[model samples]
Target: MISQSAGKIFLAEERGHNELNWFRSFNTFNFGSFYNEHKHPFESLYILNEDTLAGNRKISMLAENDSCIVLIPVVGAISFKDSAGNSGLLQAGQAQVLNVYAGTTLEISNPYEEESVNFLQIWIKTPDLQSTVPQLFEFDLDKNPNQLLELFSPQKKTLVKTVPQPHGVIGKFSGRSEAVYNPAQSGNALFAYVIEGNVEVQYRLMNPRDGLGLWDLEEMELEALSENAIVLILEIPVLKTV
Candidate 1:
């Protein structure tokens, strides 16, 4: 078994508001610019943006080969429009995955006459999608199994059809997550960022306004000891090199 750290602990901080008038809410720090150069190809397992859109306002469809995308809502509910002309509403505890194959436009809107919606957008690297179609899996609070949430996955097709096992799951632990990584999970890397509460990771404790760096490792764990402790964990598959 490959033994190593679970990686480090860090916190997710709010950046600012987005430029879109229709897309309201706090634009998170991880919301990277299109112009910004990326260091590791899929290393940037996530590009986040907490969005709050106005009624009837529409967001442009966005996609990048650089990553697989997932959306999580903190408050309010949002609907999406895809190239397949598919549309649906995603509520709190609801996770949406974006498959940007050959690029598709995604229009996000909140049309409820009473409430405004807030959500978080997360991007990760896509696994090999050869001869497979894009996928989506949803978990609702009423039926959600654990304290965690599985919002999206691009590898679901390959995992379900071939291995009978799924790659990894990104869960939001309100206070603290049982930071547990499996050894059987071969060819993967771990990333965790605190969005709400503080977490003690190994000997390193992290609070708001901090970020932990990671690379090839074995296993990592996280613990949040207080109320409202929110953490976003990204399990990115390490790309095999030649």
Candidate 2:
């Protein structure tokens, strides 16, 4: 029998380092001062951050000209103002995608005066790094309650199908549900993060904020272990591009 720790990447609750007063971030891979050369990035997926910002406080992040960024609010709301003049408000169940070509800077702050906000910041290096055009997208996930919904993809195709390219996929799983996740290609990778509640991913249980990265598999089965359980999955290419 394969142990729960075997052939799987299990990032426990305390493995992520915390920042100072304004931001508390957990690095799925080496990020910021949390440097681990061996843990720099996974394929095309570079950064995965679980961040909490104090009310009225803000944080700034720089994106390379050709990389892509996706932000999902988990608790409270955040107001994002970027160098491209793309500013908007996003609350829980809402997501924002930024195609940061030609270099971009983003400032994110908690809009509420008394409420702190927690959100996930993910970065993926795309094949279109030389493109100078930048685009921003915002969408809500309230349409589907218990099923896995695709929030963003390279081709912007339907929920289950993604273009077989060096791309990234964002999915949200809600309620006590079960689903099979098939990668866009045979040797791709999938990284799952439990946003809220508990879930048994491929027979291993994961709690809130726990992250698991799986590869070398044909398919994955996800079962929500609790009511209203919500998880986020990121699918990416097995090879990182320029």
Candidate 3:
């Protein structure tokens, strides 16, 4: 068990947005060329990048070590092939998790020639920084609307197969309603990202693609302010050393 206190909020507009010829990315925490020492990883919760790619455009693959990366498609689809000879397609209703140890390279591309695809890529740091063999897991998002659905739970091996766990809980909230979040791990922090429509966290309004990070609280209230609003919430440790 960890110490719990009042939670703080990190606004979305304060983040960095970078637009390029092939990709447009928004960084919730310092990433790529948008570096901010203060806005670095939130405890073990490292990176959250919202990206949009032009159809048929390929973003050069990623080479990382000892990191758990999750990709969720929002608007379209993406085709990916990893150095480990794993390949798959991620659509709007699906999500993918990549566990990289030691080191691995991954290539992602938009398959459709006329439609653009938008996705979110999140990185969570593990306790042990040592590298391991790369593995990929893709799962379909729960279709439950107007409620919170657990997408990934670190202790639940049946959810996804990987090491280190990250010791976090990731969920998807759909429809317009109020939901209470109780961290599976006491003293953990919460990071909520609005996928579509509007949502309010602790009385603070968040629009599409907006994000808020809360910590030190036993529970937090989340309200979907508009129809079809979708929010992704991640509960991670508040201590940086975790």
Candidate 4:
């Protein structure tokens, strides 16, 4: 059984870090060689990695079957090409969702000449795919400051038939601004990550790169402690199996 505590905070410094010649990754959960018995998968959300790729360098990974991968560029744009014949450049203001099959090689590269690129890679266990195409969503958090901007939601009719879909949103808020988030479904878990600046979630203070997981709650509260605070929220359903 999962913990029924009010919440669990994963501190930024506690994340597992991996450094390579061309890549540096910080894993929020067990991934690659970064495994922690306490840092287990949060419900259906399996992987949350903050990765930095060196300029002109690339890395490839095999996609997992029956899963969804989400990419969000943080510091710079990233160019990606997959064996499935899908390719694109994902900018900072956009999010990409890919419905991948097993054995598909996905290569992500930094397009800049001398600057490194930072991005987030999230993996969620999903239902079998009905379509293999990728989807891109563009959002301007600066234009709609202090409000949550939806990035990807499985509830969309256009989404491939992946049941029990996770909902993702990003928001930029001003200092002292407060917001309330209601889960789309009861029993769903909420994972909040502070992308920049300070914030308080459910009364727990969080710094940049910190993550908080809350479950068995109908609503969660957030308050930005600094100007231009950016946050990412994921409402994930708890699956029967890991």
The best-first sequence of candidates by TM-score reads: 4, 3, 2, 1
lDDT of 1 by residue, 1-242 (tens): 53445454333342444456555544333344422233223354545556676766667646655335576666878887777565678777667665555465677777686566777666554555442244556565434422455545445335544322223344444454465644235555655555555665444676743445455656666676655565555556665566
lDDT of 3 at 73: 82
- Give the range of the ten consecutive residues with the poorest summed lDDT in model 4: 155-164
Residue-level lDDT of model 4, residues 1-242, one tens digit each, is 43344778888899999998889999888888887888998887888999999999998878665678899999999999988888999999999988787777889999998899999998887664556668899999989999888887663564443345677889999999989888766667899999999999888899999999988888888999999999999988677654
List candidate 2 segments past 4 Å from native: 1-7, 130-143, 155-176, 185-187, 240-242
Positional deviation of 235 in candidate 2, in angstroms?
Answer: 1.1
RMSD of 1: 4.8
Which ranking of candidates, highest lDDT first? 4, 2, 3, 1
TM-score of each model, in listed order? 0.71, 0.80, 0.80, 0.91
For model 3, how does the per-residue alpha-carbon lDDT over 110-183 read when each residue is reduced to its tens digit? 99997889988887766454334334444444556666666555434323332234433333455557888776
Better of 2 and 3 by lDDT: 2
Backbone clashes counted, model 4: 0
Q: How many residue pairs clash in each candidate?
A: 12, 2, 4, 0
In model 3, the runs with Cα more than 4 Å from the true position are: 1-5, 61-65, 129-143, 155-176, 238-242
Instruction: Indicate the TM-score of model 2.
Output: 0.80
**Local distance difference test values of all predictions, in order:** 0.54, 0.70, 0.69, 0.86
Residue-level lDDT for 185 in candidate 3: 63
Return the TM-score for candidate 1, rounded to 2 decimals.
0.71
